[model samples]
Structure formats: C-alpha cells, structure tokens
Target: SDGTSLEGNVVLPDGKEVDAGEVQEPISDEVYYIAPDKCTECMGFHEEPQCAAVCPVDCCVPDDDHVETEEALLAKQRFMHPE
Candidate 1:
C-alpha cells in the first residue's frame, strides 16, 4: 500500500501559525509525531480516538503515563477548537 501523508499548519490559541515540526519532533522522513499538548484523544470530536481507529499498524495507543480525565480532555479540545 502507498503510505498516506498529513499536511497542516499548527495554529495556536493566540492565532499564530507554526510549522508542524515546531510542535513535534520528526522521528524520521516517513514517520509522524503527535504533539501531546495538542492531542485530546479525539474527546470532543468522536467517541474514540480516530487515530487509534484508523492507524494501519495500531500505533496510536494511549500514553499510559500521560493519562487525562474525560473532563480535562474535553476542556482541552474546546480550548484548541473553539466555536
């Protein structure tokens, strides 16, 4: 299968746009990194994390060491994606 690619700007709450590389370290040319502070585990958008659901290799598992409550996750989601 041909690998998929992701492209987007990392916009902050302050309205500044940043490069994806600024927020997440590049693991390699093919691998992507998720920024923990920007991740809400898809709390507000879906019942479960879509990343985990669609990951071809099942590498989007939760970080046990950085567990967060549902309320905290939702709050973060709202903060990042205000309507």
Candidate 2:
C-alpha cells in the first residue's frame, strides 16, 4: 500500500457497511462541494479541471451519477458564486 489503499471502505447511504464504490460522498461548498450550484467545474477561470489539477493524489473523479452537461455546469457556477 502506497500509504493509501486502493480498496477501502466509505460510509454507505444507509449508514452501514458497503463497498466504497457503492457510496457517494457529497461535495461541500465550504470545502469544495462543487456547490453543484456553483461549480462551473472550473468555468470562466480555468482551462481544465481545476480541482483535479490541484488535487495531490488525483483522487477527484467525475461523478458519473451526478453527471451534468457543460451548460448545466456553467449554470451551476453562476448560481453558486453569483458575485
């Protein structure tokens, strides 16, 4: 293990034991929650996936389930940071 376990456990939806692959953790605004309502996924300011680009371990993966189109993502960015 490279100080990191590829296979690990994440808290499940029902608050029980399950495969990490089966659970979904929300992204938080205060800490990078995507704000789904704010994340342009790095819109107008970045040319790439900013979070993933900055993430040290490259652990940030696109949410296939919470998937949204580019337009939706941009809309979210506007909604979250309406400044």
Candidate 3:
C-alpha cells in the first residue's frame, strides 16, 4: 500500500470548506459511510473510483445511500478544488 490518500478541503452544501478528515463516519458496524459531499468518486482524476480500481481485494464499493448524478459529482469536483 502507498499509505497515501487524497487530501484536500471539501466544500459543504452551504459553501463552507472543511478538511477532508472532518467528514462524519458511519456509526454502525454494517454501514461504511463515505461522505458524499466530499466524494467526487474520482470525477476529476479518473472515469472510475480509483480506490476500487486499485484495491487488492476490491473492497471499496460504491455507497448506495450516497448515490449522486454525474452533474453533482462534477460540481463537487469544481467546488472543492476550484481553479
């Protein structure tokens, strides 16, 4: 493992910036929540989720509860890392 992960500020729905680590985690043992607001789902980096692509066991699966459209994903990408 590279021991590296994408680190950047995430824009909240209200336009506030929060550290990536500040995202809330799942409370249940059965639920692994990835912050939808923070997850661009590799929108800016690749066509697919990079973590899932590179996982040795492919354990990184999409969060069904956090379903987002492409437009939403792209908008998030721009919001979090404006150029």
Best by TM-score: 3
Predicted model with the maximum lDDT:
3
- In candidate 3, what residue range of length 10 has the lowest lDDT sum? 1-10
Query: lDDT for every model?
Result: 0.65, 0.54, 0.66
Across 1-83, the per-residue lDDT of candidate 3 in tens digits comes to 01224356644765766676654446677845455656788887798887677778767876677788888888777766667
On lDDT, who's better, 1 or 3? 3
Once fitted onto the true fold, the runs of candidate 1 whose alpha carbons sit more than 4 angstroms away are 1-30
Clashes of each: 0, 3, 0
lDDT per residue (tens digit) for residues 1-83 in model 2: 11112245533222555453444456654555543422466775688878888898877777666777777767555543445
Clashing pairs in 1: none
Scored by lDDT, model 3 comes in at: 0.66
As for lDDT, the candidate ahead, 2 or 3, is: 3
